[model samples]
Target: MTSDCLFCRIVAGEIPATVVHETDATLAFRDIAPKAPVHVLVVPKAHYADVAELAKADPALAGQVLAAGAAVADAEGLTQDGFRVIFNAGEHGGQEVFHVHAHVLGGRPLGPMVSS
Candidate 1:
């Protein structure tokens, strides 16, 4: 785990978080600065810079992270009403956190997410 990486810190329990889900491969937790009522971040335990980084080192891990995201939505009961899974790639995309993570959002109408 990267000592300076926030996500790694979360995984290491250096920081406190309201956990939503966890597995051998990943962890899901409530976002400290949430955008929605059900905003959660799903990340791999092992650090990767971003999607571009993850895609090469562990393609299976990338798919697993996405699968876990769906599991989080299902567990949170956001599937019926519908939910959105998003990953911001870089600074240009408003990715304040460098570690690869998927944001699971729902529980209310998400209008024009791509408009911005």
Candidate 2:
């Protein structure tokens, strides 16, 4: 885990977070600044710069991260109502953190995908 990466710090226990779920390969925590009623950041234990890097380096691990997100969504009671799993790729994609993480969002109907 990188010293400067926020998510890495959380994974390494250097930073405290509201962890909702954890596994050998992944971790799920509530977003400090949540955009939705149910917003969780699910990350891989091992550090990767972003989704592209994670997918290229370890496809299976990438799947594990996604699976963890889905599991968190289900446990959060969002499965029946539906939810959105999002991976913001880069700066242009709205990714603030460099670590590879997915945002599990639900609790109410989301608006359109994009707005001007």
Candidate 3:
């Protein structure tokens, strides 16, 4: 875990977050600033700068992250109606935090995937 990464700090207990789900390999928490009614961030306990990095370093862990996000959606009752799991990459992808995280969003209708 990177000492300076925010998600790493949260995983390390140096920071506090409203965690919703956790496992040996992943942690799912509510987003501080919600974009939807049910917006949660699912991340691997071990740090990865981005999704590409995570997938390259540990594909199993990357799959676990996806599973964890799905689990979060299930727990939040987003499975039936559908939900969105997003992994923003660099600055152009709107990734504010360097750590790889999947944003599980639901609880309402989401419009277009991207706006022009």
Candidate 4:
């Protein structure tokens, strides 16, 4: 875990987050700023600069992150209707934090995948 990473701090218990689910390799928590009624961030315990780095370095752990996101959606009752899992990467992708995280969003109709 990088000492400077925000998610790493959360994983290390240096910062407080409203966690929803946890596993040996993953942690799911609610987003402080929710765009949807149900918005959760699923992240791997191990730090990665972004999803691409995580996927390339440890595919299994990346899968675990996806599984945790699915679990979060199911637990939040988003499985029935539908949900969106987003991994914002870099500045162009709108990533505010360096640590890789999956944003699981649902609870209502999420209009479009992207807006112009």
Against the unseen true structure, what C-alpha lDDT does each candidate score? 0.92, 0.92, 0.94, 0.93
The alpha-carbon deviation from the true structure for residue 15 of candidate 2, after best TM-score superposition, in angstroms, is: 0.7
The sequence of per-residue lDDT tens digits that candidate 2 reaches over residues 1-110 is 88999999999999999999999999999998887889999999999988999999999999999899989999999999899999999899898899989999988888
Best by lDDT: 3
* Model 4 TM-score relative to the real fold: 0.96
Q: In model 3, what lDDT does residue 96 have?
A: 97
Give me the displacement of residue 43 in model 4, in angstroms: 0.6
lDDT of 1: 0.92
User: Which whole-number lDDT from 0 to 100 does residue 100 have in model 1?
Assistant: 97
Residue 65 displacement in candidate 1 (angstroms)? 0.5
Better of 1 and 3 by TM-score: 3
Task: Give per-residue CA lDDT, model 1, range 1-116, as digits (tens).
Answer: 89999999999999999999999999999988788889999999999989889999999999999999999999999999999999899999878889999999988898977332
lDDT of 2: 0.92
**Where does candidate 4 stray beyond 4 Å?**
114-116
Kindly list the per-residue Cα lDDT of model 3 for residues 1-116, writing each as its tens digit. 89989999999999999999999999999999888999999999998999999999999999999999989999999999999999999999899999999999999889877322
Candidate 2 displacement at residue 53 in angstroms: 0.6
Candidate 1 ranges with C-alpha deviation above 4 Å? 114-116
Residue 1, model 1: Cα distance from true site in angstroms: 1.0
Candidate 2 local Cα displacement, residue 12, angstroms: 0.9
Q: lDDT tens string, model 4, 29-114? A: 99998988988999999999999999999999999999999999989999999999999999999999999999999988888763
